[model samples]
Target: MSLSAATLRSLKHHNYRLWAGADLVSVTGTWMQVLGVNWLILSKTGSAASVGLSLVLQALPTLLLGLWGGALADRLPSRPVVLATQVAHAVLAAVLASVAMSDPASMTPVYGLVLASGVVSAIGGPALGRFGAEVVPREDLPNALALGSVINSGGRILGMSLAGMLLPFTGAGGLFLLNAVSFFAVIASILAMRASEMHRLVHAGENSGSVRAGLAYVLRTPRLLVLLALALVLGSLGRNYQVTMAAMSAGPLDAGAGGYGLLSTVFAIGTVAGGVIAAGRPRLTIGLLLGAALLTSVAQSVSGLMPGMAAFAALILPIAAGAVIIDTTVGTRVQLDSPGDMRGRVIAVQGVVSAAAGAVGGPLLGWLCDELGPRLTLEAAGAATVAATLVAAAALARLSNVRLDRAVLLPVRGILRRAPAEQAAALP
Candidate 1:
């Protein structure tokens, strides 16, 4: 089906437009930093383990403190929180850039700076995520979510491509400097937004509950719990395929850093396509989630078995498509299903679940690659993702009365009728 005016109606909102533009710029810088860090570690230590360790430092804080961050989002204006985080990030990027420039190629202080930057990211991620819900009208939440994905996918392509090309001249230090500068673009956009125009659903000191309340609410709701479980499996363990993809390209494909960048770009192309498709659709559905998850698992498996560069690139398209579909669907559904006061905490819980998965999955997959080889490790991870999909599907199926798609698309429309009041009421 083609995108019609009704499907694209969400663009009419001014705030969403502002968010889309800012996120596009900011996320591109984040992607550049990611690539630069990976390269920096590889150059310094010549070990995959160091690469994994850096990733761990970057992500471990999220797994550990995401819930607290979520609570903080609920207690304050998300825009201000985001603004503060961006400022801190910019400073950190500048520091790293300085360190990189002085040495041209240093490891010790670079990794330490990366670790410090990750601590900042851990604070930023939940605030950034929940901020979307506050930036646009509730009716446009799904559209905003889709647009966020579009911006992120596009950013990955832009940043990774630019980093690959610029690294020769700027080195890791220069890229870090560029990343620091990019944050101002986002900061300016955010500051330009009218405070009255911000669509915040929760004001300060509104939802006062112990963190346990958030946990209890999530557990009491089977559907939300199921979705979070799937996110953990796919986002964390299944995504390890990406790490392996880089390794395989550098090894079997003999593609080097440029080749790895190409794989990222290819995957991002599919992600962009998928985000566009999702934006033009009505709302999320359970069937769509299942289909996407299964497709992602199978596609990932296929990626593992590809023989050469062309084949690998071709296989990654479907895998990336499935990945974006799942991300957009889950992201939209979580916002739609949550109560206004509890939105931040719910989103935070989701973040924690996802971070936990990545924390465990990244190192696990990295270790497996070290032991079993990239090809076998990726193939096994894909199979495991498929099994997770099956389990998620079976669990969701039991909620037969729950109209999964409608719950996501028109959350205000009464799909919650199928859900128990206690499921929502249990929120702390």
Candidate 2:
């Protein structure tokens, strides 16, 4: 397929197009709010620690209650669940805007609103995840997911750029108000979608133990276990780029804030490129995910040894690209492998693991940076990531009859075509 054709394939679906448009708006607004919040906290407290604490407050609820939310998603109608959450988000954004306008110096209400928004996100995430699949045909599901990532990366770049321009006049209050309006765009688009056209999956039946069922399912599935293990390690050790990059820019590179900003811009660009590349693929597989993870870790390790800022910056593009490929591939695999009824629960489980890794890894990596120096910290993290990938690959090879050699050599589509019926099913 031509590049445009490949990238635009998912947009052929009407529902997906609507969802994509709305999501782009929503994600852009979200990034603006993120930047506004960081700026506000820094200005008010003049403490980096305070800014970090605000982020932790936002992520904590998602880490703790995500699974229960997923279970709820499985039991309820996805549309209603999503609508409710979007409304909740809008209300919170409006409240935050009011507080910012009325009492800009008060940190307590701002923190409370951020925490509330996080709670709504934790509950809505799984439903929104499953809803995306419902909007597109099965063959287009991967493309839709890839496109979603593209929207996220593109929006972050756009929103951050716009925030820089808008913040001087509007203040954080204006940005919050803009985000509040963005939520309505999504709500309107969703309302416009044809319910009958959606490829609705069968809902998981109501059960008191539904959340536990998701946990049990993961424990029983070897492929899922391996996938999660790799995710845990990569997320915890390899993916704490904020900490590593900040330390590297300030300490070893002596590049300061400008260098950090440049690095972030480059990484975001690379991520957008990766998402477009992933959208072109016809299928995703375990081999692709593992290969991407291994490549990313290796590249990060090598980049840490670069002698100058320019050389390190050059290497960061591939590192960022590889990370995005790994994330998209793993997410696609999880959605594909899961049964319709259990998809929400499975996604929630993945979210929980990722959140937990971030919660733990951020502090650990920061400590490592202080103790071992930034360059050594990156090298150590890369080594840990490589070790985790190897262990996961070994277990997969033994449990699922996956040949590492073949997995490494074959294109995902070719590998699927060549495998025996039962072996293909068994191959992770």
Best by TM-score: 2
User: Which residue pairs in model 2 clash with each other?
Assistant: none
lDDT of 2: 0.85
lDDT of 1 by residue, 256-307 (tens): 9989978877877888977776666556555566766776787777777888
lDDT (Cα atoms) of all candidates against the true structure: 0.75, 0.85
Tell me the lDDT of model 1 at 339. Answer: 71
Scored by lDDT, the top model is: 2
How many pairs collide in each candidate, listed in order? 1, 0
Off by over 4 Å in 1: 1-8, 44-48, 104-108, 204-207, 247-262, 302-312, 367-379, 402-428
**Which residue pairs collide in model 1, if any?**
285-405
- How would you encode candidate 2's per-residue C-alpha lDDT over 1-428 as one tens digit per residue? 78689778999888888999999899999989999899888988999999988889999988889998989888888999999999999999999888888856669888999999989999999999989889998878888888888999999899988989999999998999999999998899999998888999888876633999988988999888889888989989887787888898998999999999888888898899888877876665677676677778888888789877898888888788777877888889889988988898899998988898899999999999999999998898998898887787778777767676545434333423644212322244
Q: What TM-score does prediction 1 earn?
A: 0.84
